[model samples]
Structure formats: structure tokens, C-alpha cells
Target: MKTKITLNKYLLVSLLLPVLLFSCKKFGDVNIDPTKSSNLNPVNQLVFTQLRFAGDVTINERTSIIMTMPMVQQISGAYYNRYGSTYIKNKQYMSELWEIGYPNDVLNIADAVERTQSDPLKTNLNAMCRIMKVYIFARMTDLYGDIPYSEAGKAYATGIVHPKFDAQKDIYDDFFKELKEAGNSLNTSKDAVGQELFYHGDISKWKKFANSLRLRLAMRLVKVDPEKAKAEVQDAYNSGLFTDNTDICKVDYNNITNGYAEIRGNGVSVGINQYVDDGRPRVCNTLINEMKQTNDPRLQYIARAYWTNPDRLSDRLDVTDQVKAQVGLLGVDAGHYNYDNFLGAINIDYPGRGTISVPNGGQKAQLADFLVRSDAPFFHLTYAEVEFLLAEATVRWNLNLGGNAKTLYEKGLEAACTQLSLFPNGPVLTSTQIQNFKQDNQLAPGKELQTIDNQIWVALLMNAPEAYANWRRTGYPALIPAITAESTTTTIPRRFEYPLSEREQNAANIEKALTALGGKDDWTGRVWWDKK
Candidate 1:
């Protein structure tokens, strides 16, 4: 029964395929200004490239659930098909982003770069393409460890069906360099030759984005390469980065049929207008408890509690009537932990304790619209994130950044609060409320590093990949080990294993990569930057 109602994480792309085809159809057969069209010209090519960026960067609802959300503990479930319990061995889930991301997003950017390289007027377009390309490749390498960067997505011209994996360090070096050069090359006077998806053709905003990404990419090297990390912090700080949310890399769904919008708007998105709520996964307890402990207002943004007990479907309260009573359950393997454990975890209150729960007869809280809303802006980077990075940079390397760690930490929380307000309908954190949040969640003057890292983890709720990377780097948030950890006899995975399809088709390169990676390609293998 392949009904639309039963569609899950895997079917999202299948639904979008027809939309991709539909996108190619001519509008009224009049060519619709071929130079400014979505195909066969520079505008169209950049549009496609930007659309691809929207998809792979967690804007698409599918990967947001099955990949980043669960891995980072922002969302989870004990249900049969959710990501919480099945993450480590779910090779198909691990592989989907790679399969779709590289070919569609990376290759399109490459095409745009080629098409605009020689045009002096298209410098902004070409530079944006390069930065977007680096952003995509950075995500790829960060998640999967070493990846095909030098020759990836080049089957058309280079015919490199099996691109060899570049070393992660080398890939990161190139990414930083590309961002620096592209940020400098962006001509503020020369606007994009087309409809710019993120910042709307504002070249200054694009430069801010590039420099912000530099801060992000450099911060990843803090533990592994201190010298390089310090240098990057200095470089990025001097490059004139984002001071507010306006410059954050936000993907607007203005053109619905393009990149992330079409993919996430499909039948499988739980936030879809007609989506069924019967089997949707819930927000995880790890995040809920953290928010509850601080009396955080953002809980209203992330979760919607039940009006009546979810266990009683006959008398089930309309979701519309529910108040914001958040009850989050810790993630455990499906069928292994029972209803009793759930009830026990939820049926308690914490007064000034680190973890707190609001009981509701063992039911879990569904993710709020601030998360699942189809039109919610897909955030690629934020001013809060940069502030967090600067906070850490100041503390760790004693960098000469203007602000101290505490000020930057508070600013990060403020920006995160402001960012959530952008969601269509959510709890509003007013100026007073924001000030109270900062007051309540103040860092102990001595433990600045762990304190700042914990706040960063809380700030990065819907952002999965970056959160996971930070977890690997700093190891704050101190989550309980997975139930599967004892049986599998391993800690949480470090990197997603290379897809099995590569093993079958590109065996030679796969072998070389595996051998370079200490003779295994499973989750336990660390990336070059994860030496800590």
C-alpha cells in the first residue's frame, strides 16, 4: 500500500523527482526571458545551484529527520521507523544525503562556475557559486570524513566515475582558501546577475556569509590544529563578518518549486499541509530537559504538548486544543524499552535540578512548527554561531578578539532567541525575556569552555550537522550512552561510513580510502580534525 499517508523519510526524494521534471517544463512556451530563466542561462544555473544548497544543508525535511536531528539528539523516537534507535546500522539513511547531495548540488555549482568564470560582470555570481560549493563540500567532508573533493561530480567532462577521496585536512585547507579568495573577489558594486536566493543579491551580505563560514571551518580545527585554528580566527574576525541575523544564510521558500522548497514540500514532510500525525517522531528529552532546567521560553518554539493523553486515541484531544506542556522521553532502542520506563521518566518534576520532565502519561511531545513548519527559513549559518565560535576562540587560544568569552556567549544565546522568532508562529522571546534568559543561564566565571559549549549545543537545536561536529569536538551536553552501545560495544559513531554502493562500483578508490583510514570505514573511525 504505497499510499501518501504512509510515506516516510526515504520517500521524500521520490516525490520530489516529478517536481524536478516539472521544473524543466517551459512556462507558456514563450521562453520567459531566457537570460533570466531557471535553466539554459547563468540565472537558471545559479538558481539550480542555490536550490541544491538548500536541500543538502538540512533545509530538506528528510535528512533533517533521518540524518542530523537524531544524530545530534534534537529529535528522536522509540517508534519502529525513526532514527533514534536505528542510526548506527542504518546504512541507507547514512548514504542518502551523499547520493543526492554531491551529484545534484555540487555538480550544479561546478556548472555555474564554469559558465561564469570568464565574464567580468558575473564575478559576484561566480564568487557566490564558489562559496556555496565550498559550503557543500565542507558539509560532505565534515560528515563522512574524507570525500571525493578533487574530482567529485565530474563524470560529464573528467569522466572520473570513481573519484579518489582527498585527505580531510587537505580538503579543509582548500575550503578555507576558497572561502577567503571568493569573499575578496565578490564585487559589492556588481550585484548577482539573477535572483539571489539567500541574501537577495547583496554582495556585502554574501561576503559576511563567506567570512562567517571561515569562522565555522576554522573553529573545527581548534583541537586538532591549534596554530592553523588561531590564524583562521584572526583572519575571519578581520574580514568583517555578520553582526546580526539579517546576514545569516537563510533560505527563503519564495520560489517554491526550486531546491529545498520543492523537496521539503513533498508528501513525506510531516509539516506538509495535509500531513498525517499518526506516526510522526517526537522531540527528544535531552533538549527538553536542558530547556526546562533554565525555564527556557524556547520550549514553546520546539514542542507542542498534548491536550489529552496521546495513549487514548478515542478521547484524543485535538492537537489544536493542546497547550504547550512539553513532555520529552529519552531515546532508547525500539521495543527494548517499554511503556513503564517512559512513564517513569516523564512522571516527575525537577526543582533546580539539571534535568526536568513534565509528565503526561508516558506520551512524547511532537516537534513544534518552529521545527516542522515547511516555510520556516532553513538556516545555514547565524550571527549566534559566529559569536559562539568567537567565545571559544577567545577562551582557548587567547585570541585578540574584542569581546571576552562571556559577552560572546550571552550574545550567542540572544541571537539564537532572535533567530527562532523568525518562525511563522512560535513563542516570542521579548527583550525582557531575552535578558532574563541571559540572567538565568549565566556561565560560571571559571568553567567558561564547558559552559559555553553547553550553551552552543542548546542554541543549535534544529541545526544537526554542526551540532554533531561540535559534540565530537567539545563533548559537552554529556548525553547518556545509547542502549545499543552495550550490545554493539561501541560509543556513538564519529563519522558516517562510506555508502555500500561505493564498495560495489568504486571498489578500488573505496579500498584506498579505507586503507588510508586505518583499514576500516565504519562509524568508529575519526576524521582528521577529531583528534581530541
Candidate 2:
């Protein structure tokens, strides 16, 4: 049985409970508003944080879909893709993750952790909050490098109006410490953590998630600090890791077609599918060709071509016929002018090829309907990722992670394919198909790192932040930067520029961070763990 948690009415209540209970107070005063009761439930705050972490449309659209996805060459051709695919910098788009993440995700979880940490009855809740706090900060520090970590979200708590920017190394060191402490603290004998979103209050699953997340962060240090990476990876591996697909960490959103403010639906899905027919995302040739070369069984399930109606250009007909489907499964090449001339390139006549509607507006291969549904699950971390990381550790550091690299690599492949079923209406692979794919794609000798990282690229579909980070760290599935004259830079961006608001509001701290970034707030500057 699938171990997925769904959003419900109680979760909605949990979302609004804190807001109803607490009111804002002026800075330099006590954190709690004098008008309302000081008593705020940490469980409600935890639920709200978890929902917003996966449900922020601004972050999902600006960072994941537009910026990270195209930068990684997973999908392209949408108007917003220029920001990442063609390297055109947009301050608003680049800053969305930081602007939204700090106020919405980080603050809420930080508050929850603070509220529950000292309470004996809230031990499990506090542990979950701490784990979530680390998860939120990990993404922030990964994307923007040094950020307001030690004092972030403390404005209301400790009157820290302008927090200092903590270095990425310091932030990562704390992440390992927090994850370890939190994972060790989760106990079934303690609080039940009512209205839980991820695991439905399953203490064991939360423990595994903490370890899996720690392993991920540990592996990110492979280039910058190999010894530290090996030690952390081995420690996280031995402590415990996701054993199978059932332990995959994800948030299953309800089928609510609400706006960006609503946390009941999948934000990434809403962002991608919200675009009109002409503006919908098309699979990039990089991803399509990668799968095509390997005869990947997931291609059909993940991508599809649509037929536009001649009478009504906005109407799209799903190309269900197999023969025509093959001819229509064409992906847009990044930085090409094909975004405007979609029909001209794929105008071939097939047996079932219907008449083209707008001569210049043919449908390219887009994500499958089920994959983009508003109710689709947002994958936080997966068992496949843990397995792949283990495989990499074994190959790169020669660590005995309970199995050889080949065995772990195959298991990772299997888990990657199998985990798709967790999504609403997602594809389910047969045992035979899984085995055949594994057999056909054995890890190449002396190319194990590249091969494993390449599979990781495929496995991280839709989760673009992780995909972008892994590409930067491993440099696998070598990609050439888009060479168009309209591009903003000659290379892929290493990190997002700090928000302009940071300069205006917190000038000193932002300047200190920028000084560490070599006196410029630009994408070419690498994060601490991202070594040359």
C-alpha cells in the first residue's frame, strides 16, 4: 500500500489556526501580540510550514519551473524559460525563492521549533519541526549561498530586524547537527504530532527522512571536502536511510483548483499548467534524447504530444494513437526560435497525422496530463535518491555500503521508476519492464559516477532545484550552455543573485555577504560547497 498523506479539512484548520491565535506586534517589543493570546499551537504551525514549503506558487513557478528546470535542460520553450534556458537574468524571478521562502516557510518552521523545543509533551512535534527547519534552510543556502540563517525569522522572536548572513559552510554544519539531533529525538513514546502532513505522525518514517536528508547534504560536500563527505555519508548510511519507495518523503496535495495562496494543491503543477496552450512547457531535446537513447520506459508516461484544433486554436486534442505519438514526440531545442514556429519543424505527415490547425502553431511534446495535475504529489526526497547517493559513495570512495555499486545502481533505477506510482494517476511499471531496463542499462566500468549521476538527473524530474544542484556538484550529463546572442551570460548560472530588497532593507549584512561572494552579487559566484 502507498504511504502518502493527503490534505484535508483538519489541515486547512491547521493552516489558519496560528493566524487566528496570534497577531503581529511592533519590532523591539515582545514577539507575541498583546491583543491576542500568547498560546500558539506548534503542531498547527508545523502543518502550515509543511504545506507552504510545497505549496508556494511563486517559488515553484519562478525558481523550479522557469529558472532551474531550463537551466538544467529538463524542459524549455516557454516564455519564462529564457531566464534559465537562455541565461536572461530577471531580478524578480531570481529572488522569488528567497523572498517567499524566508517570510513564509522559514519563519513559520523556525517559530514552531522554538515553541516546542523546551516542552516535554511536544518532543516529537519539536523534532519534526527541527527536521523541517533544516530542510527549508538547506534549499535556501543551496540556491543563494550565504543567507540570514542564525538570526533569520527571529525578528518577531528576538527583535532581530536585520539578521547577519551566515556562511554556507556554517549553515551546512548546523544542518548535519540539527538533523542528527532531531532524528535521534523522534520517539513513539512521546507526542503523536496530530495533523501531520508528510508521514501522518509516523516516527520511524520521520527518522529515515532525517537521515536521508543528511546524506543528501553530506554528498553535496564531495567536491569541497571529500573526507567530511565520506564520513557524513557513511554515518548517515549506517544510522538509517530510506529502504524503499514507501519511505519516500513527499507531500500529496488535494485536487483543489485554488489560487497561489491556497495550500491544498500542488504549486508546481498549478504553475506549469496555468499557462495557456501556446505557453505550456515543452520537453527539451536534452531530456528527450537522453531517454530515447536508453529506451527509457518512462518517456511515454511522462511526455505526450497534443493536436491543436483547426477551428479553435486554443483547444488541444491528446494524440493517443501510438504511431502518430512516436512522430509527434518531438522536444524543443533550447535557445531555438522554435517557440514561435512550433509547427514548421514537426510538420511531417504520419499515417494518423491529423490536419494542422494553425500552420505555425503545432503542439510539441509536453508533460503528460497526470503528471501536471494540481493534485500531484510534490516529491521532497525519494528512496531512489538515497540509493543513488549510496551507489556514488561506493564507487567514488570505495565504501562498503552493504552492496556493490552495480547492485545499488540497479536498485536505484528500480526505485526511481517505481516511485512514480506515488503521484495521482502516475504510471506503474511491471516487474519485467523494471528488470529489463536495469539489465539493459548496467553501470559502465570507469564511468560509474557519470552514469549514476546521469540517472539521478532523470530521477529528479520536476524537482528542479535538486537537479540544478546535482548538475553543479557532479557535472554529469554534460550540458553546453545556450549559445544564443540573446543570452545574458556565456555559462549556466552558479547561484541566484541576492534579492534587491536585501540591499535596501539590510544593507550592512547584505554587503558582508556580497563581500564574501567576491564583491559582486551575481550568478557566476559559486556557493561554499560548490568548488571549482
Candidate 3:
């Protein structure tokens, strides 16, 4: 009887065990949210990455407007602008790009590239990802030398919580290789990428962009590695480039006011417009004066001003009145505009200020409405830039880039002018006006390189980082460093310092990078390609 009872208990326990285990498993699944998944769609990931690249308000404000734009002397007259205009160190502004770039743009794009690598159906998507990865890293390495390249964006896949910073030289080499491979890999016969932001999955356009970017990167090597630069430029040119304005790589943003978190609106436009009443930036005399001196037709489209009264919204005067527009087209001298005495010294009178005596913040020109609208297109790479690079290569290396330096230079100027119409309500430059400007601004005999780079400077107006990079490489337009009592340094900053977070979280790798940088992590240090 005892043996029979024991056997029956064992048999019943065994039967219940499987049922209990299955119940626990089902309960575990209930805790997991069905709406959330570990797997990411590569197409959606790519779209998000592209949008964040152009639509990060923090980056646009801290890096571009406050730092690069003022450093390049394109725009100024804001208190925050002192960081670049007067060479004052603001660690927050200096580190924003590195801090934001890695976690957001780098991580997502890297994942997309990795996920699509083995899928046969995702060939074009993979190619686009590769090209975009290069673009993102190039901008990063250009600004902050020796960032984590190979090991970046691999935290989830490889458990690399801390990535090693690769040398800029090695990174550049990889950039060229990746661009070449990606450009060649692009196939129209493959599945079209529905979520592409820059080109809408247009394989041909993507191909042109990749090569044009290669040409631009090659030009950066002029002072560092001329042999490599020439070879790369020749190869990229021969491969094919942007034939016209339509091939320009850009993001046309919608007029959305959902703040920085919203990716549909242009972050740069939102950034600049936020300070419309306070510390509003006026076009720098360096830029406006250059345009005025050259009789550049784009000046009318690029700059405008209003008589502003911060106290009253309705008190602003429109630039449509030709008389007021002419008077308000004044560009402020950067470092000099911060003083109270300087503000008092300006004798200009605005009838719309309610009282001409009040010197409301509108004493100087502001960026035009069309240029700063929430929907303005952010130009990533353009045919104008490609033409200018080719022109520079022709002059510097005597390479046959399908046209003489003069012809290419004029084509760049026309393309630059023509692309402005892409902006919301942007003015159209008539063919005659473009031709007249081209005729007047022809490349000078002794100053071919200078002329080409100066126009490159003008063409890259809103894209401040690119303009700053070009200025560093070519030293065109001959900017004098801002001389002010408030300045922390006499020289312009060559590159951004590493983020403070790197010091706290990734100390060892950052220390290794600092050692390579001669044991200092300051803006004065030059990147590899920016050799003096």
C-alpha cells in the first residue's frame, strides 16, 4: 500500500511539472510589451538618422550658429556668439557635437549598416548606409580629430561600451575606401529604399553625391597629402559627379513648430529664429561687405533686416519698403558689437521703433525671413561645392576635370545662385542676372585659387562647419582673427575639444587620443588634414 501511494505521487508531480513551466513562460511573455521589439527596421532607422543629422536643434545652435558661423565671421552679434567671435571657451558649446553625434546619428546609422549588410534584398539600402556612415564620420572627424570610427555604434552588437578613438589619417583612408565601394555598389535594379530622406532612394543621385563628397575630402588633403589628394580627385571626377543643381544633396524641411524634438522642421532655421528679439544675429560685415563689393546678386536674397521692438510684436518694420531695407542692410562688425558704447554710437534712426531715440535691438541687419523660415532646406552637399572643388583641383594640380578652371568656377557660381530658389519663398535669379554676376566675378589670373575658395565660402553660407573647414584648408577670404579684450585666444580655434563626458566615461581611450594630440584637448590643436 505505501509503495503504491509513492508511485502515484511521483506520477502526478511529473504531469504537473510541464504545465507549471509552460504557465511561467506564458506569464513572462505577458510582461514583455508587444509594441516594443529588439529588432529595428533598417529603413526606418535610416530615415531617423538622416532627420536627426539635419534637425538637431542643440547641435545647430551650439556648434553651427554660436561657434562655426561666428568663427567664420558669417554671422554675429549674439551674446553666445562671443564663444566663436571673441574666442571665449564654452565647454557646453564646444562639446555638443561629440556628445550628441555618437549616441544619436552614429549609433542608429551604424546599426542600419550592420543589419542590412547580409540581406540580399537590402543591397541599395546597405550602400546608402555605407555612404551616409562615411558622411557622418567625416563631419565628426573633421571637427573633432581622432574619434571612435571602427568601434563606434557597436555597443549593443559587440558590447563595446567604450570605443577606441581611431586616428584621423586612418579614418580618412577608410572614408575614401568606403565611398568608392559604396558608390560602385549602388544598383538601381535592387529594392528601392522608401525611407530615404536626402535622395528618396534615387541611386543615380546617391552615386553623384558619394563621388562629389570624395572629391571634397580629397581637396582637404591638399596641404597634408598632395599625391593622395590628386589621385583621389582624378578618380572621383572620372567616376562621375553632380551634373547640375538637381543633384544637390539637401533636406527640404516642413514648416513645423513642434520645437527641437520635431524632425520635420529645419533645426538651423528654428535655432536662428528663436533669438529674433534677443541677441539676434546680423550678417557679418565680412560676408555682406564681400557680397556688396563683388556686386553679387545673391545679396538681395540672402540678407534683410527689420526695425524691431522686443516689447511690441507689431512694432517690427518689414524690409519690403526699399528705403528701410537699404538702411537696414547693415552688417555688424563681430567683436565690436557687444559693447554698450558701440550700441550708443550707432546713429541710425528707425521710424518703426515707435521712438527713434530707443535704439531697439534692430539697429543692424538680421538674416532674411526666407533664409530663416522653419521650412528652409538644409544643403548637405551641392553641385556648386563639387564644381568649386574641381576648379580648385584644376588650378592647384592642373588636372583636366572636364572643363577649364574658369568655366568650372563660373558654373559653380551659377549653381550656387540657382540653388537658393530651393528655400521656401526663395527669390529666383534670372539667367541674365546670373550671367552678369558670373561675368563680373570671373576668376582672376593670379588669384584663381583664392577666387574659387572665396566663392566656395559664399556658396556655403548656412552650412557654417563646411565653410569653417574650407577656410582652415585654403585660408581664403583672408579672415583676420577677432581682436578683443574679452578674447581667450588671439588665434581662431582649429578644432573642438573632446566632450567632458568622454573624460568621465571613456577616460582611457580619450587619454590615448589626448596623448596622440600631444597631451592637450584644446581647440587650438589642429586635426590631421588641417596641417599648417
Model 1 lDDT per residue over 1-532, tens place = 1111222332344334324422543455564532222444555545555544544333344455555656666665534224433444667767866887776776666666776789887888888888888988887788888888888866554567778888898999998899999999988678554365677678888889999999989988978898999999899999988998877886643212233435423212332222233345566667777778887777765665433333322333323222224323232223132232445334333334434344433355656544554445567788888898898899887777768877888889899888887666656689998899889877776778887887788777666677888888888777665545323424566787788898898888778778756998877788889885
Cα lDDT tens digits for candidate 3, 1-532 = 2312322333333233223222322233665533223345667666666766767788887889889999999988878788889899888898888887877778777877887999999999999999999999988999999999999988755779999999999999999999999999999999898557788788999999999999999999999999999999999999999999999998777666466655566788777767656467778888988998889999977776565534322346654244343344566786646333244323344455443332434546667778877677899999999999999999988998999998898889999999988877788999999999988888878999888999999999989999999999999879988879998888999999988888999999999898767899989999889998
Measured on C-alpha atoms, candidate 3 has an lDDT of: 0.80
Q: Residue 122 of model 1: what lDDT?
A: 83
Better of 1 and 3 by TM-score: 3
All candidates' TM-scores?
0.81, 0.92, 0.89
Least accurate 10 contiguous residues by lDDT in model 3: 17-26
Model 1's alpha-carbon lDDT is: 0.66
Encode model 2's per-residue lDDT on 328-383: one tens digit a residue.
56778876534555454334343565553333334567777777777788899999
List per-candidate RMSD values in Å. 7.8, 3.4, 12.0
Q: Give me the displacement of residue 113 in model 3, in angstroms.
A: 0.6
What is the C-alpha RMSD, rounded to one decimal, of candidate 1? 7.8
